[model samples]
Target: MSATRTGGRNGERPVDPEPLPHPVVDNHCHLDIAPYAAPDEPVPVAQALARSAAVGVPRIVQIGCDLPGARWARETANEFDAIVAGVALHPNEAPRLDAAGRLDEALAEIADLATDPRVRAVGETGLDTFRTGPEGREAQERSFRRHIELAQDLDKTLVIHDRDAHADVLRLIDETGAPNRWVMHCFSGDAEFAAACLERGAYLSFAGTVTFKNAQPLRDALLAAPADRILVETDAPYLTPEPHRGRPNASYLVPLTVRAMAAVRGADLAELCRAIDANTETAFGGTWGA
Candidate 1:
């Protein structure tokens, strides 16, 4: 069974201004930024969604990191038929969740999220040595483990968030024995690191960083990524791709990064669209082949 409203090659309907290059899947985005953001926000959710729709961002995983944020993610995604939810404790925010020590509480929160059919993946979780200190490392590790367990228990795909802790993240994934079809969200490591993760059955997702001229290494690594294993993300309102780089990011901008990914993979726009769209659908437990 497939979602008739938003799936496959015919997932999109025509919008304004420009023709959509192709339908895209925004692998990750934090919609929970509303609390910290201004109430009279310039970029309203509808506006952001319209922009995304305009550019053929047919599906997006609105990730929720904190307790309130996760709840908001659900509400926000519910507002749009095409958007889905990916609920998890971001590494930096993992300390706020007591999943490792008070697992029942954490499980309850997860169950609350999972009860909603649209919450597709279980993360934005994993190690982040670049930001986490020694005191926070233990909690981060515990949170990562709990997220893995949560994915296993819920039978949802895991969206890993690894940053400057590639080795540690790989160790944890190996030690825990991850379920099939996990995506390394916003993968930041080099080609070798990507290869290592690929060997472990984890898909490497590239973000707008690959579009940076200085990101030649990311460019090279992307070439090594097999078509079946490559995915694209915005990590928005951050990592906006070129021309729009450094500006507020959104799912609508996914096509820019998708174009860059296609160039790296030596695939044309159509081929890249089909491949990435299929991989994203598979990652989120949706049927891709029509």
Candidate 2:
């Protein structure tokens, strides 16, 4: 539905995981890219939501990191009661648009879209040093600062996408002052970085990546994070969890991540699910209808 040849486009669709004991929201997902990654046919937003609902994932934050995706996110949120929107240009995209001298124009449009009721956050933003090199860092930082300011200006939650740039992300947040509400989407840092983010009142949203055998550090971060400040997401159709690694991810697979989080935190499964539901609402402002 958005973005061409996304990271998700390579895997086969996986079977659904067991249903969660309590309702939870996939704090981040890319409904627009689900079909491109796994199956031949695109799963309509309605079908995707229904599939998730049948399990206990009742809501989702549809993140749009480009202009067209932003439009899709807002429109989809408006059409579906279970969805909300977050808009921004991804860090890697910032330099491309900047080189074309259209960065400001794009940011301006994002600013305009940020005012929509269904648009609950101003992100999928922040530094992504992994994909964006040195020459692109300036534009990424510039775009990040702009998004932080936009979130503050609009009193909306900020969703950050920190990839191999944890220090810079913390620096930028400190320099600009984080919004009242913000989340480290698909948090990939260790306990130290997790502590840093927690110190700044950032919610740590764990994705399926946490279930990887090599993700002990991330699990440690989860263990260290305060219960109220934790969230769960699929980041679909990527980072498919254990038992389904290399397969297409979706909201329905959230239960796998939630279960892993529960085990890591040594908390009750249903309790963790309930906390994730509440944490997601608090992180994104509130439930879509409320």
Candidate 3:
């Protein structure tokens, strides 16, 4: 879904940060959600790719939050050599579809779209108590379980989105059993919570939020996470990194987050980049694009 930014720096696009010493994949991004682009204009996919590639982020996993988005993700992945697709009804979306009595129909379409070769993951799924309330919890959990099974059955990576529902997310994973490969996208957990997820064999994908001033806990998680289990993402048009916090984000800005992550973990920049690059391949069930 496209996120609307209001006031001040939100309207400004930040200048690109220095390129990374080594390339890495943006494991999660909504290239289709172009809040900074002109109305009715689809996100400038080619331009975005070029900008990101120029900054050492040469590949991206385009995530689809709904049926329309799922189809677009598959089509975009097919058109671009530097992109792969992750298709699913987002956590908030599930409750809405269920309320409309169309959840099953939408999920069936996601399953079909997921079968496409360019679609490498079944995700952006899980729980979101922050946006969804008790009235929707059952539908949300049900959808999360189905997506988990779909990923396992299709042998695709599972990319989970947990927002203010950490325990329940872990509970569902424990109940359903995780897929061979799974990621905690935009991981918003403390070091202790991070250990819990890591114990489940999850790859914790950190985003620009890790660079926020109030995100010391997130940084602690990054520091505690093992090198091979860490991944990076932009979640673009959303979690733009520091010095550019309120601006519209794109994959080109990944270096800022990766640099902050390296500093947090007190690790060598290029080595951390190399590990994240390799971890993404393992987490996502192999490499795609350039």
Candidate 4:
């Protein structure tokens, strides 16, 4: 994701929120993208992990949306006990690669990287109408279909990134068949849409966007979701939670979103945390970083 995509304050990182009552996994995060810092500043992967763990986010699933990112995520997961990797070519990227005649080559590399033990999921791959225009839709759908098939064949969790393309996402899933384990990452749909995903056996992951004042429909979806199938994420460097909504985000800020979710769902904080943790493991195909 681009650092400027979410329109965050960028000057100051948000203060850490109170720790969660129990630990929960950040089911999706882009540790490689540090929008808060400058180009010369190294990505503080270790520091990010420590801060998040201090606030009860002990594990994270680092997602790689392109070639270099896929490699970085794999390498980072191998180095950090608290992280696992998810690899794919983002929907927007697919068109560019296709235009350059590199889409096939890129997907081939993603396939290779995804087989690693440290890589638990194959995605962040799905339709994204908000960014890519009509000209790119075909390439996006083609990529999404390939990633879906790849996930099933490899027995890895399929993590989808649906943005303003919910109907097409569900249609593609129905056409290709959902995998044994899949997630609607950073779920941006309403109660009815949530029901559609849940019916298709998806783990709906709420991100910091859930805390936005304008996100009543998202909150309703949270309330409508069953606890067992719910998950949480930061999608950091983007979608920073409210109160800190226009600021650079990191996993340490996850508690803010989780707390908001509990409030919306009228669920106990600790119980919600526990369910999210377990749901993440299930969504990602078991535990790591023990």
Candidate 5:
């Protein structure tokens, strides 16, 4: 994927900040897509991983929203001790696959990938009303439900991507009986919705968007979320946090968002980092060890 599609639209990667006092995992990132890299070239996975580790973000859950990406993720995880994988057919991709009558085949591939030990989660899957219209919703929902079942049956964590379809996303999860471990990835919900998801034992993973000035509601939700249930991600090279809002983001830039979240919740930065670290391990089952 081009850097622009991965969050490198500005063609400028933000300078790395000082490392955090405690180690933390970037629960969600796309090292393969290299959003925080040059326009045509991905930031090499080794480079991204090293840069992140230098700054105290030692581990990452590499998400692959399609088959090729899933393959990349699995191979990458197997090759690198610092990374784990999550595989799924994205909600937006579902309708297109269904239209081409290939959704089932694609899903079968995802199911097979889900069983791989290095692939700890099934995700970047859920509803996306912002992009897909009513015409594509049925396929999206069908895909989401299937992924949920796959996650449950395989006993892998379910990583969700809800965008402008909060109510329906919650409804479906409730209707299907959510997997034992699930995450609201790049969580974009209010306190009420946070409470709802927390009630279902979902971990809320906040991304750089939480640092936007207008995202106080997100900050409020962060405050509302229990300490042990919170995790942080770059979701890079997108949602770059404040001070670098429009620039390319990377896992190394996670401290900016973590600091913002700490301030919002009136908590000590190191304590929050430790909590998120533990929360991430719990959410994904364990760290990716060589």
Candidate 6:
């Protein structure tokens, strides 16, 4: 029950990241950075992998932020029987403006990273307007489009991150005429945005944040979403659900979110579990623990 910690950035030994006692699917986590150190510090990848398996997350997709993270995501996933990989250049991780000339090349590197067999999805890519201005927004969009195209080309599921820019995100999805079968991970949009994404045939993923009492509006949106299109994730080492709200989040904590989902949709926990388990498999193209 000790908190995990990692070597500073790339060289420190991370804290113990043991798994938990619930059936869970960690749809998204930066395996290379699972909160081992202080809030802003990086968690050692090894601990993250071990912790994921220890918890009963039947399947997990560890995402990468850059080239090295890409390699590690694949290698670590390949090593673990239950872990899978998702590679993408996170919006803020993309190179800065002056060096933005390398953005396309950087994103291409990520797409190439997805070519690995263990890589079942293509992002954590999308807009992050909450923190970025116009220029950064433009860069995020450029990178996001490529991620979508890569997923389409590889026939892999797209993992989208739509924060406050839901409208623009929808516009881009329409413009790309991107194929259906993507996942809107950690869906924070309102009922309207949920409708827009559902219209595009994109799958919706719910996280622990939806369990908060103040998140009833979010629950309302979840209620509006089609059950088949719904999925669940720990999004851990972040967004831990109620009861464990302030605790360090992990895949094991997903059942709480699952329970919350059940409460929101008025379904039984077992049925809710089955629904999301199926949705998780579909989101990853039926590639579970393989």
The residue pairs in collision within model 6 are 5-15, 5-36, 6-14, 7-12, 17-51, 19-54, 19-55, 20-55
Per-model RMSD to reference: 7.0, 1.5, 2.4, 2.3, 1.7, 4.8
Model 4 gets an lDDT of 0.89
User: C-alpha displacement of 172 in model 3, angstroms?
Assistant: 0.4
Pairs that collide, model 2: 1-32, 8-37, 9-37
Q: Model 1 has how many clashing residue pairs?
A: 0
Which residue pairs in candidate 4 have backbone atoms (N, alpha carbon, C) closer than 3 angstroms, thus clashing? 8-246, 9-246
TM-scores vs. true structure, each candidate: 0.86, 0.96, 0.95, 0.96, 0.96, 0.85
Q: Quickly count the clashes in candidate 6.
A: 8
Model 6 regions more than 4 Å off: 1-22, 36-56, 95-100
Q: Give candidate 1's TM-score.
A: 0.86
Worst 10 residues of 2 by lDDT: 1-10
Q: After TM-score superposition, what is the CA distance of residue 209 in candidate 4 from its true location, in Å?
A: 0.9
Across 1-290, the per-residue lDDT of candidate 1 in tens digits comes to 11111111211212233334668788898644521223224246667777787778867788876666677777877777778888877788765454346534764686668667777888778888778777788888887887888788778889998888988998999888887679998888788988998998888889999999999888888999898888888886577788765455667778778878878878888778878888888888885221
lDDT of 5 by residue, 1-290 (tens): 32324444565777888889899999888876755446567888888889989989988899989877888888888888889999999899999999999999999999998889999999989999999999999999999999999999998999999999999999999999999899999999989989999999899999999988788788889999989999999887778888988888889999888998989999999999999999998899865572
lDDT of 2 by residue, 176-289 (tens): 999999999999999999999999999999999999999999999999999999999988888889888887888999998899899888999998888888888888997569
lDDT, each prediction? 0.75, 0.90, 0.90, 0.89, 0.89, 0.73
Please list the residue runs of candidate 1 whose C-alpha ends up more than 4 Å from where it truly belongs after superposition: 1-20, 34-42, 96-107, 287-290
lDDT of 2: 0.90
Candidate 4, residues 1-290: lDDT per residue as tens digits? 22212323455777888999999999899887756645335347888889999999999999999898899889999988889999999999999999999999999999999999999999899999999999999999999999999999999999999999999999999999999999999999999999999999999999999988899999999999998999999998788899987778889999999999999988899999999888887788876853
lDDT of 5 at 285: 87
Residue 100 CA displacement from its true place in model 4, Å: 0.2
Write down the worst ten-residue block by lDDT for model 3.
1-10
For model 4, state the Cα shift of residue 265 in Å.
0.9
What are the runs in model 3 whose C-alpha is more than 4 Å off? 1-10, 37-39
